[model samples]
Target: ISPQTCTEGFAYDRRARQCIDVDECRTLPDACRGDMRCVNQNGGYLPEIPADPEPPSYPRVRTTAQCILGYTPAEDGTCNDIDECETNSHHCNPTQVCINTAGGYTCSCTEGYWLIGGQCQDIDECRYGYCQQLCANVPGSYSCSCNPGFILNTDSRTCQDVDECADEPCTHACFNTYGSFMCNCDEGFELAADGTSCIDLDECSFSEFLCQHRCVNTPGSFSCVCPLGYYVFEDGRSCEDINECDTGNNTCTTAQVCFNFQGGHTCLDPLQCHSPYIEVSDNQCMCSAENPACRDKPFTILYRHMDLSSGRSVPADIFQMQATTRYPGAFYIFQIKSGNEGREFYMRQTSNVSATLVLSRPIKGPREVVLDLEMVTVNNVINFRGSSIIRLTIFVSEHPF
Candidate 1:
C-alpha cells in the first residue's frame, strides 16, 4: 500500500486508493454525548435522544465562556471589564476608588491610602512632618503628642511648657526654671532639709562670740553683756568702769569724802578730832586730857609725848584707837616703820566694822613714824580703812623736871 496522510475525521484506505470518512462515534460509542448513546450514519455519527431527568428541561444550557458580574461581552465571547467606576455598579471600599482592567475591576486607595497586594491599605501621613513635637500614625490618619512637662498647643500640632511653678508651691521665694522650679530663703533664714520650707538661723550658736563678754541670742538678733565690775557701753558691745564715786552710788559715810578710782572708790575723813582729846586714828580721837574718868571708858586711847620725861611706863591705856569698816568679819593689819619699836603696832578685829590699834610703847618723838592700816576680809579682799597719823603733847616745867 502507498503511504498516505489523513485529516482528523478521515483515514487513507490503501484498497480504495483514496481518503474516506470514518464514523468515530460508531467505532467508539461512548464518544458522542455524555448523556446519550451514539447512532451510525453515512459518513458520520449522531447522538440518540436522552430521557430527561426533569420533564421538558434541557439542564439549563451549560455555558463554556464564564464571566463575572458587571462585565461586557468580548468578540470571542469572553467577559470584559464593564468600567464599573463610571457605570456605578462597584462596591469598593469608601476609602478607595474602582479601577477597570482587562477582565475585572480593581479597588485603589485614595490620596491618603495605597493599594497593597489585593487590599487597599493606609499610607503613613505622619512621614510628612505633620506635628511639631510628636506624630503618631493611625489607620488613614495621624495625631500629635507632647513630651513630658509639655502640653499640646491650640494648633494641635505644636507643644508648649506646662508652667509647673504657677501654683506657688515654695514656702518662701519661688523661682521658675525651664521645666521646673526652685525654692529659696531670705538672708537671715535657711532652706529646710526638705527644700520646701524656710527656717530661722541662730547666728549666736554658729559664731564664736557675738558679744564682747557675754552673748545672748534672740529670735533674729543677738546681744552683748558686760561682766562684773564693768558696765555696758553706749554701743552695747563694750565694757567700761562705772566710777561709783562720780555717780554718787557709793555707800561711804557722809563724814567721809569719796574719791573715785578705777573700778572702785576710797573714803577719807576731813577733820581731826577736837582738843581735850587727841587724834589717834584716821577717824577717831582719844581723851588725852588728864581725866581718869575719860581714861576709864570701855574704848582705848593713844598718846604720843614730844619729850621723854618720865621713865615710868605710861599706862597701857595710852596707846589704843579704833577704826570702823562696813564689811563683816573685817580684819585690820597696822604697819608702822619707825625705830625697832614700830614693829610693836598691832591691829585687832573686834566686830564686822570695828578694829583697834595699840602700840607696845608710847610715842616718844623727835622722830617721824609712818603708819599703814589695811582692812580686809577673810579671803584677803580689802574693803575700807586706811593709814594716817595721831598726835600728842608734852608739858614742860622748869626744875619741875
Candidate 2:
C-alpha cells in the first residue's frame, strides 16, 4: 500500500478510519444566497456585504484597532478618547467650553462663571483654576461661594470679607479689621437714614415754624419757603409780594378794567342795571330809567324739537336754538350748567318754538359749574340826555341741588 491512499481513493479500512475529500461546490452549488460572496479560510468563512443594503452588520467579521472607537495600539489597545474637534464625534453643549486632552477631553466653565452649560463634560482635577471658597463639582466645572455674611476676598482665594454690619456680633460702621472686624458708629454721628453709616444733627425744630413764609429742614440743615406771592428779599428774613404787573403778566382780563391796589390787582366785572341811561358804579354800569320795567311786553327764549333730525348721543356743550321771532320776549338764562347730578343736555334734535317772558321770582344762591354765557334783549333805545341807550340787567344763577 502507498502512503497517499490505500485503495482507489481512501477506502474505508477496518482498523484505520479513512475517507476521501468531498467537493462541496459540486454537491451544493447554491450555498450562499443574495449578493453575498463567501470565501473559506483556515477554520472560518467570510462574506462580502451587499452593496444594495442600507447598513451592514456582521458579528462574525473581524475588525482592526484603527477602525474602532478609543482604540490605540500605543496605549496597549486600551479605550481612549478621540480628539472630537480633530477627529469625528465632537458635540459640545450649548455655551459649554470643550477641550481635548491626552486620550480624553475636559470641560470647564468660561470666565466669570462656575456653572456648567448642562451637558456632557469631563472634569479636570489637576488644574489650578477653581472657584474661591467651597468649590462644588457641577456638570461641567465647579461653583464658588463665600461663607454666610462673608463675601469673597477676590484678591486671594482663601480670605473673605465679613459684613460686620449684617453680622449681629458687630457693634457699630462695620470696619473690616484683618481676618475679622467690628461695627461702629462715629462720634456726633447717629445711625444713617439707611441704617448703614453715622449721620450729623440738625439744630432747627421739626415743627415747620421758623419764618413768616415757610420752613424746611434736612439732615443737619434747614430752610424756609416763602409764600406763593411773597419772595425772600435782600434781608433774607422778611418776605415781599412779587409784583406780577411789573413783569407785564398780571392776571387782569381787560387792560382798561384793571386797577393796581395795595398788594394786588383787582378784577372788575362789567355790570348792567335796568336803566334808560347807564351809570358806572363799582365795576358795574347801572341804569337809572323811569320806565325800565318789562311789566308790559316781556322777552323770552323759545324751545321746541323742530328739526326732528336726531344726532349722535354726545353731550351738548353749546347750542344756538333760533327762536320763532328774535323780538319781543327774551328768556332769562336761569340754570346754565351741568344739572341732574351728572345729567347733561344732549342735542340729538333741535326746535324753533316761540316763547314770551314775564318777570318771575329772582333766584338767590348759585350752584356748581356756573358758565359765563349771558344775553339780554334791548326793547327800546331811550336816551335820558345825550348819553347811551337803555339797557336791561340780566342775572343768571344755577340750581343748588
Candidate 3:
C-alpha cells in the first residue's frame, strides 16, 4: 500500500495517522489578501464575499491567480490597493493613530505623547527651565510658579517681589524690603514679641535717678513727681524747695514774722530788749552797767530759733552752742534751766567751749517750746566768774515728714 497523499489546505499527521485541515490564515502570510475575510474548509480555503453587491461594470468572477497581503484581484483581473484603516482592520493600540496609505496603514502616538514598546507614553516637558522661580510638569504640558513672598508677573515666566507692608501687618510702623517686611514702634513705645504689636516702655524702671522724688509710669511715657513742700524743677527730674514766705503762702499772725528755711517756714516774735538789757545787734543783747537790776542778770543774751518736725526721736541733738572767746584757766558748765519743766530737753557739754541741746523726749506739734540755756565760766586762778544765756525758741511742725 502507498503512503496517503493529502490535498491542498490539508496536512497528513504522522502521529494520528490521519489527514487534518490546515489553517491557511495562520500558516500562509498572503492567504487573506487586503481587506477580504478568509474562511477554511476541509481541503481548501475561500475568500468571503463583499457586503456590497458587484456593480454592473465590475462583475464578480472566479480567478486562479493569488495576490499579496495588501492587494486583491478585481473584476478586471488586476490586483488593486486596499484601505485597511477604512475597514478597521489595522492593528494599533487604543492611544495610537491609524493612518491609511495606498495599500497599508501606520500607527503613531498622539500629541504630547511618544510611542514606546508598542504603547503610548506621556512626555515630561518640565525638564527645561521655563519658569523663573518654580516649575511644575503635567502629563502633556508644564506650569510656572513663584516662591513665597513673590508674585507672577504679566509675562507668566518671571517673578516679582510682593509688598507685604501694604497690608499693614505692623501696629505702629511698617517697612517693606525685598521679599520681606519689618515692624517698628513709636518714640515711647516698644515692639512686642509678636513683631506686629506695640507695648508701653517702662522708662522709670530703667534708672533710680530718673526722678528726684518719685517716678510715675504712664502709657508709653513716664513722669517725675515731687513731695509735698517741693516742686518739680524745669528739668523735669529734680525737686526744688517751695519758698512759702516769698510766695506768701505762709500762715503767720500779725505779731509774728515769717522766716523761710530749706523745706519749711516759721513764725517768730520780733526781738525785744527790756530795761536791764540793751539790744546791741539783731541777735545779741548786752546788760546796762548803770542799772541796779543788771547786777544779777547774765552778761549777754543771744537769741536763736530752730524748726523741727513733730515726733522727733529721743536723744536727738538739735542745736550746738559754742563760745566765741576762750580764756586761760577758764572752765565752763552748761544747763537747760527753765524749759526742763516738762523734762523734754537737756544739755550735753562736748568740750569746755561747746555744748549741744538734746531732746530727751518725743514732742508732738504744732507747738512751740522756749528754753533758757545758760553757760557759766569760772577761773579760780583769776578769781573771776562770768555767765551768758541763750533764749532758744523751738517750732515743731504738724507733720512728721
Which prediction has the highest TM-score against the true structure?
3
Candidate of highest lDDT: 3
The Cα local distance difference test for each model comes to 0.57, 0.41, 0.79
Better of 1 and 2 by lDDT: 1
In model 3, the clashing pairs are none
**Which RMSD values do the candidates have, in order?**
22.7, 29.3, 12.5
Q: What's the lDDT for residue 184 in model 1?
A: 89
Which regions of candidate 1 fall more than 4 Å away from where they truly are?
Answer: 1-150, 162-166, 219-221, 225-401
Report the candidate with higher lDDT, 1 versus 3: 3
How many pairs of residues collide in model 1?
0
lDDT tens string, model 1, 209-317? 5555677766446677765546878888766666677788988898887755333445645646564556566556666436665543323333343322222243332
Q: Estimate, for each residue in 67-184, the C-alpha lDDT of model 3 and write its tens digit.
A: 4457765765445778888889999899898988776889988776889998888877666676788988777667788988899999888899999999999998999988778999
| Candidate 3 residue runs with Cα over 4 Å from true position | 1-138, 142-148, 205-208, 248-255, 272-301, 305-321, 332-376, 383-401
- The TM-score that candidate 2 achieves is 0.22
Steric clash count of candidate 2: 11
TM-score for each model: 0.35, 0.22, 0.55
* Candidate 2, superposed: residue stretches over 4 Å from native: 1-200, 203-208, 218-220, 235-237, 251-256, 259-266, 269-277, 281-401
